[model samples]
Target chain A: MTDGFVTASGVSRHFTPSLPLGERIVAAFGGAVERRSVRAVDQVDLSLRKGEALGLVGESGCGKTTLGRMIAGILPPSDGALAIAGEPVMTCGASPRKTTTRVQMVFQDPFASLDPRMRIGDALAEGPIHHGLVSKAGAVAYVRDWLGQVGLEPDYVSRYPHQFSGGQRQRVAIARALAMRPDVLVCDEPVASLDVSIQAQIINLFLKLRRELDLTLLFISHDLGVVRHLCDRVAIMYLGRIVEEGPTHEVYADPRHPYTQALLDSVPKLVLEEGAEVRFKPIQGELPSPLAPPPGCHFHLRCPFAAERCAVERPTLRPVATGRRAACHFAKTDLNIITGSSSSPAVIASGAKQSS
Target chain B: MIDRASPLARFFGEFRESRAAVFGLVVVGLMIGLALLAPLITPQDPYDLASLTLRDARRPPGYVGTAGFTHWLGTDAQGRDLLSAILYGLRISIQMGLVAGAIGLVLGASVGTTAAYLGGRVEAFVMRLIDLQLSFPAILLAFVIAALLGQGKWQLVAALVAAQYAYFARTAHGAAAAERHKDYVEAALSTPLPARRVVFRHILPNALPPLIVVATVQIASAISLEATLSFLGVGLPPTEPSLGMLIANGFPYMLSGRYWISIYPGVALIILIFAVNLVGDQIRDQLNPRLRR
Candidate 1:
């Protein structure tokens, strides 16, 4: 494994179910009920290269957000090792203050992410001032500058978060994260809650900030189309495990795992050709609960080409091609292929690439 | 140069629109004014021994006595003008209420914030202490403390403060705990701020509004407790003549045709408590935006 800027090796997080009143009453009869554990993220190893955007795509219940939180130091990894810039992140008694300054997270709901009571200026200055990145007056200037950088007017700084639109609040949240001057910015579905038109604006703003500030990004989203446009590399997560990982173009062009292929087929694409009707098929069945994830390859139950071996033996992530990785047994074989006759440039360009 | 059209101004504008709140404010303002102007507004000094005459004692309202003009509210058993005694008593009651409320607010806020910020054992310990204090009735707890310390203004104030601080602490602790989970507080923590600054400056301001409402309501409760303690003969000595003492001294003569003795001071106490409660209600209405709508 090369020394990428941010790395998580076999990281896992488990949450114990808190004993409710009913559970406590049941336990009083000398019968102990086993507490359930939710394996949010399991045995995941990946590296985010410096100054590159990594998109982590998964369904709602998948551990993409949990993995993002682990990287951001909001939730510590329950097992395995994590490092930033070759420095270890997960340790028994490490200072969280130091780790938090290195990486910041922009949450899914911009409104929920920002404090309603705080003014935009105070919200932006809080991180910078606390981190000793700047003096009080200097932090004010930094806040104004970052607000400007995020396409918000400097004059809007004095206003409260509720006074701003949803997109503007997200921009303020971005400004707050930037105030700390972190090396990596983990965006946990930053634009998932925004309007379609506003999503583009926020995405463009993120791209602009990433380029200008030389910031590494871990962008998590369920929307593959948004991920395809913004990320340099994409990782498809299913049932708390990354089913496939590759460069954005390669992964979307030729998704090795059946789950990845299904995800790609599910995204609605615009057919520019006259008289061409593009058919969209949504993924079948509901997501399995994290508490009792299936044995062997977690996706085996949902995979179209699941063999007996897939149900019995868990497949580890292995190199399928150059800069491409997949956890399926039949990586070489294109088991499931859904083709459309649209000559859209995106599809043509992506189809030729074959590795993300 | 504050903005006259700012959101705070708009909030106040909305506050004034509430008839209950406005009426409450007016009543509180008048009571506070009466307390402040006790000396200038009243002709007779409540505490002066020479001015008091037993000959005019327990006179009814509007009765003209031999000693100058009799008060419309008449006199108490001590011949102290009921109106003058009330004005003076209001001054003492207001002073004790404000002091005890301030002490409770400070002590409770500090303890509550510390407990909420440093959870686990500390939270359990502090919350248990609150529970212990709450389990015993507030007036009973005040009586116990007053008995232990002996009777004095400070003793009564101390008892009232102890009784009230627990409520403030519980409210502040809950508010601080809620604020602690908010993003702004986490954002502050992620910065280089020392834990104290994060807890005090950033977390405290946001947590205080709810506590402010609690404090306002507690002020009325504390005053009532003080009056109760005094009425029971464990608070302010006879010479001091607080509203509670006056009410206590006049209660025996209620059926003896001297209705003015108890009625005047009772009305004054009720008015003061009512005014304070009204103001507290207004504060609750104003501070909570959810209530306004």
Candidate 2:
């Protein structure tokens, strides 16, 4: 499949301090109005291929959701450009209805996503009805079919969201998104709030939908296992920028960046042999406030491999291998490779050869 | 037949069992019946001045008057039958309360929802207006409004509507504001649904229960406000005697031997207010989950 159905170039969004009560008083007293800028997303360039499931793996405050929101056009970017299927992402001034119909988002909390007062059928029928995609009677039939596709009973269409379980609500959310027949689906941790078994079910459903509908998916999650299982390619974000990105297997098997390596090592392995040695290097320190991100490399304060040069010179995402990229100066050499205990010399050698 | 014992059924059943609500329902129902059957039930047309006999005027209840048993509750200062006056007066009072409450609800819901949804400067302005209105006692505001508009049933209704709309608007605005940030609202926005549809069809319906309770309570408040205005002589015109007017006119005779003339209408007024308050309380209980259990 061709790469990049939806693409963002140097997209940035900043939220300025609103005129708070204190600020208003200060202004009245002839004091200087101090407005702080919170850069939620900063100059991030990314692309999602057609029918490809691209997982955005990051910690809670890494701005993955913000980036996803920008991609969905729910929030307008302060600067730069975003496009879907070779067309510019419609602005707020333009026909907002048309733009919203083309792209849809499934939020993290499923229960909150569906209106409690609305019956499932009404909720599902709303989009199609507003868009004039189907007649009212046709929409009812379509809603039933979509419900079945999401593994919900057709008879349950009349039920309210509160009557359903968490997983069922999420399924209803998915069904709602599917009803729009969006070209790109941006799911912001759709399974994060669900149970582990339910998470697996949702992940499987996402994978299934991706194949069946030939849809482009932007899946956001902090769970590495989930990213590894469902994503075709993975983008690792730190602060508000992509630190490492490549094919899912490549990034997991041989993560070149120090941050990527640390993340992989932190994952609890199934078994450890005697003297196999588990040097767990959990990511130290809490994330700094986005309102005032540190100078130079944002990760330099917490990065283990931080040098004098690393602190001064900010790194940009540069190509490392074919279809793979990372934003570290020492991405190729400084990262320590950890070979699997089960691997033979021949297997390791062959694997290294294949990677090269 | 249906199970008739579901949670909703139980809720309705509890409402039916509430003494206050039941009493209020009965009183309201009786008042409505009285209004509908006023012409047929009453022996004298209270509004017709020519039909009244001067000799029967100022007679107390159970008095051996010119009319005898025909005027069972006796006659007013104008020789109007007290029973007939009460029926007609109640009709005016109930009409004023309902119309005023309805106007308040519509006005409040519109203003409040608009202010909340389109926040920033609009919210501040609307909230300030609400604060200003709330500072004055509602009954005082109604009296002032009625005085300015001139005294009549419609004028009093208008006064009550003006006094009570701010309360409902503030309530509905808060509810609508809370619902606006909900994920479903955002979800609706993310879909191809129009902004108007998202705000009204999706968000407004979910936000209405609290406002519904507020509207119910306001009905009681509206009735009381109207009565207070009428008692002060700034409400309904003298031609139409509401319960408040009857009480006002009978106050002088209250000191004399005839107690039933003022006492019966006062009792009816209390019972009507009590019934309305009871129904309002039950609605508040049913709508609010914390109060339900």
Candidate 3:
């Protein structure tokens, strides 16, 4: 009971893609055929207390969606453990039927998420009907209520998904998820595919739902501004690991991890400090392929403050403050040092030279 | 706030783009009408053994022969009314196409969706079998099946279905496999809903449009396959006078001067199959988002 309603400890998802036929045949014949396993979610720990809105922010392929999916029970973790409401969430078809109803997910793409053949009413009513919360006779009224909860008109219930706009369809998806009456709602970039104007509306809807429903929200997004606006706490992910996590405002005001600082810096804003000489730009280097993640710290290759020890020793998440954790060797000291010297490239180059 | 267009509006808009589809619709509608009204429209029961005679056999069109207007399209060398025979044939052709299509569609869709949803060895086994079936041309497979069953109504339909269901299954598998991983399907499975319910209710419905278009096309092919088997003398008995039987019965006389015997029924079969194909193509094109323009 002390832990959050949903707890994921060292949960990971790895996929071993099969080779094509020609390559398979060659491999079968003993010819060399390389096989790579993608560690999509690598030993990530997350916890969500009831009625808490925790935003998971990361670049694409950093396993934000994968982590969300694992939480929602759509996918099983490759290793480690997860518990919902102190009951272990079983992977590989072992969880009871009731376990599925306890957590639900809202997907990113509304266009592809809903069945085009299904009427909106059926989509909304399916969960309640399946869960035996309502009979067929009562499903209509129940679905209407859920539809209203998602801000959709109950009159538009009979329409197909293709008949609705993307935003409307997303509302239906939310209603569909909410219909299960889940304690935890894992929204995997639900507003990423929406328009900027529409994104705000959906975010506001989520905020309102959080207030009214008192649901635990594991909101995954790359949008830092949206995360700051909607989340009470935010976890920054880099290469399938939570590099830093803290209260949203505190994290925004001062991100301890270099990766989090770089991510926050990338957000475009209208305001600028008058006569400011220092400006923030996106971090250098592409996100390395998950198949062959760099040794030690995943972000060590891209980190500006990479000293000799940073390349060889992988940093574990450690407590930096009362309710915050960061997985950097120098999370507290890096920002002060970077600010003190606007031209800090020479120090980083010299460190790398010394390490080599 | 994008205004929602009704499904009917979109369908009609797509239909208007293809004139051949409209023509096909008319022809198919006429054939269906002919099937339903076969008993009322036919001058004599082609199935009635006592009605056929040698005297009215092979008479040319507009004949002042024994049957008069009954020999309007000329006799099929059995003295059976050609128009009556054609009408009866429509009934059988339409029934065979629909029944076989339905059977094949249901079986194939179920199997395909199962294979796709439950991947791994299930997919491998089912898909390899579909591949094996696909390796042989559909006609050869149908010919072998019909050859085994000999000649009858249900027998012919069964053979055609056995030969045809694989393609429908393949179509369903391809579409269902694509739809299987979709987030909504995952979301449905994540509910208290059973895997079977999710597979059928959510996954299957999304997978059906392509299967539906394929079913229409399959019906046309099934009819053609039935006729081909009949023409080869293994489909229906001459007693049935299916369009293929009529064509086969009259095929020998085409060497002589009497061309109307086989020519008329042949034309009917062509029109029937071609019209169905046209409808299928139009529906497929309409369903395909890539071809929407």
Predicted model with the maximum TM-score: 3
State the weakest 10-residue window (summed lDDT) of model 1 chain A. Answer: A334-343
Tens digits of lDDT, candidate 1, A1-356: 54788999999989888789788788888778888899888889989989989999999878998898788766678888778897765345643433447788788887777776667788788767766788987877788899899999998878877678889889988888888898899899999999999999999998888989999999999999899999999999987899899999988877777788778878777864687556466777778788998888888777666667778878878776777888876565332333222123324333433432
- Root-mean-square deviation of each candidate, in angstroms? 5.3, 5.2, 4.4
Clashing pairs in 1: A130-B191, A130-B192, A130-B193, A131-B191, A131-B192, A246-A356, A247-A356, A250-A355, A250-A356, A251-A356
What is candidate 3's lDDT per residue for A318-337, written digit by digit as tens?
A: 76666888887665633323
In candidate 1, how many Å is residue A267 off? 1.4
Residues A217-257, model 2: lDDT tens digits? 99999999999999999999988889989999998887766
Tell me the deviation in Å of residue A312 in model 2.
2.8
For candidate 1, the docking band is acceptable
Query: A346, model 1: CA deviation in Å?
Result: 26
RMSD in angstroms between candidate 3 and the native structure over all alpha carbons: 4.4
* Candidate 3: clashing pairs of residues: none
Winning model by DockQ: 3
Rank by DockQ (best first): 3, 2, 1
True contacts kept of 1: 0.22
Q: Give the per-residue lDDT of model 3 (tens digit) for B1-293.
A: 35477777878887887899999999999999988999998888877868777888888876655544546788767787788888889888788889999999999999999999889887999899999998999889888888888878888888998899999999999999998898788877777578889888988887888998999989988888888899898897776757888888888999898999899888999999999999989999888989766
| C-alpha lDDT values of all predictions | 0.81, 0.81, 0.84
The true-versus-predicted C-alpha distance at residue A279 of model 2, in Å, is: 5.9
Model 1 lDDT tens row, B22-103: 7877887888899899999897897898988889888888867656876878888888788888999988888888899999
TM-score of 2: 0.90
